[model samples]
Target: MILVSYFARYREQLNLGGEKLPLDASLNTVDDIRQRLIARGGVWADIFSESNLMCAVNQDLCRLDQAVEDFDEIAFFPPVTGG
Candidate 1:
């Protein structure tokens, strides 16, 4: 299984903290997982459509192309800004 999490605005927007998804061969990378979520349409599509969306794998910030493995933790959030 893959543990997917949403942080900050993403969590609030989705009204979800995280979820576990069954591991699948088709979900080879972070982008693939994202595409899966986006495929859900509606709010899922809208939230993931942002070009500035950020991702992390196993607590390490990574690109969308980052490889995903079973039992890995994936997180998504918007870019951070502070004064």
Candidate 2:
């Protein structure tokens, strides 16, 4: 299984902090996982559609093309900003 987490506005909007999903052919890459979330529609689609959103894998910063595997921890969050 893969652990998916959301942070900041993403967590608030989705009303979910984390969830587990089976690792399968349909979710081989970070982008695939993202697309799946987007497919949920409504708030999910809006949050993930943000081009500046950030994604991480196993606590390390990663790209959308990054490979995903079983037992991996993936995190999605909005871009940080400073005033």
Candidate 3:
């Protein structure tokens, strides 16, 4: 399982703070997981529509194609806007 979280505007838009997903699916990378979420339609599509979407794997910066492991803490949020 993977712990997925959303913050800032994304949390409000998705109406969720976080969730857990099974690793049974062939989603080994962040990008793969994103595509699956986009397929869910509604707010998910919007959350993932941007190429600059910020992501963290266990709270560390990570990329879309980055590999993930079970129980990994994955967080998604828009890029920080403050200076």
Candidate 4:
């Protein structure tokens, strides 16, 4: 199983905090998981736009092409902003 989490505005906009998906051949990278989320359409497509999103695998920042495996935790959020 894979754990997917949406943060900040993404959580509110998607009307979900997190979800779990079974790991399979169709899902292999961080981007693959993101594409699946966007397939949900509506706000999901907008919120998960590749240009505006940041992804993390197992708490470590990573690129969309990063490899993923079963039981990994994937987090998606907008780029961080701070003073």
Better of 3 and 4 by TM-score: 4
Candidate 1 on 1-83: residue-level lDDT in tens? 99999999989989999999999889999999999999999999998988999999999999999999999999999999999
Model 3 bad stretches (over 4 Å): none
Judged by whole-model lDDT over C-alpha atoms, candidate 3 comes out at 0.90
Model 1, position 39, has a per-residue lDDT of: 98
User: Each candidate: what lDDT?
Assistant: 0.96, 0.94, 0.90, 0.90
Candidate 3's residue-wise lDDT over 18-52, tens digit each? 99999866888998888889999978987797888
The prediction achieving the highest TM-score against the true structure is: 1
Q: TM-score for all predictions?
A: 0.97, 0.96, 0.94, 0.95
For model 2, residues 1-83, the per-residue Cα lDDT tens digits are 99999999888988889999999889999999999999999988899889997999999999999999999999999999999
Superposition error at 78 for model 4 (Å):
0.8
Give each prediction's root-mean-square deviation over alpha carbons. Answer: 0.6, 0.8, 1.0, 0.9
lDDT of 1: 0.96
Per-residue lDDT of 82 in model 4: 100
Model 4 gets an lDDT of: 0.90
TM-score ranking, best first: 1, 2, 4, 3
lDDT of 4 by residue, 47-72 (tens): 88759689899999999999999999
Question: Stretches of candidate 4 above 4 Å error?
Answer: none
Error (Å) of candidate 3 at residue 70 is 0.6
